[model samples]
Target: MADLVDSFTPSDPSDKSPFTFLNRLPTKRLDAKITRAAESGIPQQGAQTGGYTPSYLYLSHVPLFPLYSDRQHELLAKEDKHKQLMIKAMNDADPDKKLTGGQKAFLGTIGHLVGAGSIVSTQRWERRLVGSNVMSADSRMKQDKLLIFTRWTVPAPPGRQRQGPLWFVDVLEQRYDESSTSSLKSLSGNATMLKVGVADGRKVTLQLLKTEAKGIKTQKMWSKGTKTDTCEAMTFVGDNEIVAMEIVARIERTASMVEAMEVRKRFDKEWLVPMVQ
Candidate 1:
């Protein structure tokens, strides 16, 4: 017993023994190279491009979210039934009773996960360019003119088809003189006129009117102080007369002119600017 105890006894701190290998190991230094290498493992960011561009330049590459299809809906229903069964199992005390908070949260998270994995077709707006004839007419106009065509889907009015939403295509053109420095000076002078204001509802109303009219185009100065205040020619196509009238009526019924202007701004930014490159 004495010999066994001696063989198993711990060595002195200064003594070299089989276990001393651990003590001899060097502490790792915090090398900047190692830190940098670890940091390189993180994602590298690329340059970010923001703001609007012509639709013709990048519309085809835009990603679209697809609506749920009938088959997907059916599968979702089945999944829901399965979830209900599992929830009942989790709370066997009363199968028909409402789920407890914990069970509901668990099931809701699972539903989202399953839904994410399901397959569905995607959709994006169609886009093109118009007024090519004018662009080709003169080199000077070519430098100043930009025309973009794009369409966005809106919920169909009641009693319309459910397969897809209604699509409204808008043609927007931007024109400015590049050769003249005075043009830039004028823009700088009227900079405050470019401020966005809610009282600018008439501008959209007038633009809508020009869109409804045939063979007539209107150009306005930027002194209007609205985002849509910029000088441009616009036209709306592929809108059903009845639906267009209904939509216009809805806008006209907005609580106040300010609300209407806000709605207009929101729609342009969300639906129009996204088409820009």
Candidate 2:
């Protein structure tokens, strides 16, 4: 089966057409597995199923999310901002369809959540924006470069072919044997994103300015000589290329739902028990 899968190269790594390793799937059991994996966000977890959700949801499921201090902090800040806005909007609205213009602006995104077009709210909008993307020296002192991990551990979509939670990672600089443009075009999907941006010799560091808590937890210094934390100096790649983009579809969780309900239940039990007594 592995050989059979190996023989068929997906147009991209994610095509998953009916003819691919997918076809070998004995529909019912395979579907159950996929569904289970989707909800559990892992096959062994629980009553999880697979389908389309946002990239962030997928990020949440990963056992470990490794990011630089600044990047992780930025992402958290972004999520908080969006949550606040959502809370405000949900509270102020009439609950009926009679929406004011401001409410109308938010309808698209809300609708998307309930199965419409891929909508993003303004509060969380920049998270989707193609901001600074780059590729730098693995390390100047002790160089180590391998561009192969472009394929992230992000998951595949569940049922609907129409939904997309795509990603855009840009290549900032031109590196030897790397073409940012082609790489960007190659990784076209709804599950993951990669874009590239060029750095003009200025020392680049993604720093977290707002919060005191450093977001970057795990850092791999690919080279031996450098600081024990950072990977080797990032290499310049592409022709000043801001390249690569992936939008890997995410499978939202069953356990998270369970966790939420459990929390609410426990809270309610606590409150009700006190009141009854």
Candidate 3:
């Protein structure tokens, strides 16, 4: 596996396809034994599922910094200041009544859960990776970029179905081998960095990598030397399938198309979203 990843980095950037190389990385399947070994490492015990099916692999594209710029915040604050008197008036008139637009706007600024987004929100989103199993890592990965060992013990609660997979991620910063550079370039090129909020209303930047093949689109983003409490660093790969369901509309062909479309959308929302998220 290591040899494959190491060799995957193309000698000539234009000569090889990075996505093809990445797609070819070995896919490891989990049986009862592998699951048990992974589960045993978890601090929290859970009912053992002897085996877990490999789900599809995906990359999450997150912003490198907060969504709101300093100028935006400054302007919003100034605008909110103008509404202070009105907000106070609304609060005093009906303390128990529904919140007004100004009140909501003020609250949005004060609260981290606003639609504008925040650092705390990003952190919470990142931690979602915890308790999820990582099937494999890119071969080009190493101490310089990221190093993920095949032998791992991920922590999980006993039978927490809501938890996607268990992961114990590690961070590293080292120089990549010559071959690895090509892979890195492929992942890094043209992909923009995003501004994502961190904890306590802070923000950071992240790089994006997006690739699609065989009807699967993998969008990835990365941050350097950043680690969460339980969630570490790892790329998760799983299995995804397209199920063909028959929907027959006896009266109208259009109705059948609509029904089929609805079913497909629902299928993607339910099965596909969970696998990637």
Candidate 4:
């Protein structure tokens, strides 16, 4: 992961190209749109008609709470069933003994364990299993502080079929630190593990078990053949890699801006042509 990070070449901060790697990410683009709308000097509408005017449709990106895909919904249902069954078993064992908080927590962990093992079978399925939502300031702040790389999932492109190498995007959610026996945790003791919130209100424990630069061959919309681009990739650590890369890039850009400002300040402080003395 460190090697991959070291190998990354930061994009130009001043470049206004929307095709830039970060800008290309769906969530990043959505985030940018929201930010632009907020900054634009347009008069906001009344609460009765929704916050922004009808023109600003992208602002309405908030997901309904407990967002779940069909599979996630099924998993959740199974977990609920498991909990109910456990509770029933406890009741059957001893009618006098009430269910304790600890026991309930245990049952919840067991349920997640059962679900996590069956998250997805292949990378394609993994991409489909994930979903997207609006990135929140709070979530972004948390990710910026804790992770060296930004974590993101490569959501399947719109429509039935798509091609090309899967590029990772940073998930704008908080890290999961629930339980030691959590299914999100890496089974191997040697692997670095972190349970992170992904799309669809789902939490996944990713293990830093693999790292490689994947060559993504993408065909242009109008051009022929394919363009092979080397994408720095990692198994579960892609989030961390992106986070670190962006953070470093941000810091560098900020420093350059500050330096330029300071240089201007210094020039102003010193007489350019003897200060009209």
Candidate 3 global Cα RMSD: 30.4
In candidate 1, how many clashes are counted?
0
Error of 1 at 24 (Å): 98
Which ranges in model 3 have alpha carbons more than 4 Å from their true place? 1-156, 163-175, 178-222, 225-277
Per-residue alpha-carbon lDDT of model 2 for 1-277, expressed as tens digits?
Answer: 5432212223344535334434344434433332332222111112323332355453433322111123323433443454444334433332222445665555544543452212212222222121111010101101111111121221233564522333212211111222222233233221111221222222222211221111111121111111122211222223343222242222222221223223223322321100000
Q: Would you estimate the TM-scores of all the predictions?
A: 0.19, 0.16, 0.13, 0.21
lDDT of 4 at 201: 31
Write one digit per residue (lDDT tens) for candidate 1, span 1-277.
Answer: 2321111222243446433332233212212222222222211111212222343223445432111123433443443454344333333332113455675455445533453111110000000011111112111211222222222223345786643322222323222323433233244211111111122222322233323332222122222222233323333333343223211100011011122223334334443222221
Provide C-alpha RMSD values for all models, in order: 27.5, 26.7, 30.4, 29.1
**Model 3, position 231: C-alpha lDDT score:** 20
Top candidate when judged by lDDT against the true structure = 1
**TM-score result, candidate 1:** 0.19
TM-score of the candidate numbered 4? 0.21
> What's model 2's TM-score?
0.16
The numbered model that scores best in TM-score is 4
Write one digit per residue (lDDT tens) for candidate 3, span 1-277. 6532212222334534434334244412222222332323211111111112132111212111111123433433443343343334433333224456775455446544333222222222222222122111111111122111111122233575534432211111122223433334333322111111122222222111121112123222222322222122222222442222111100101111112223223322322111112
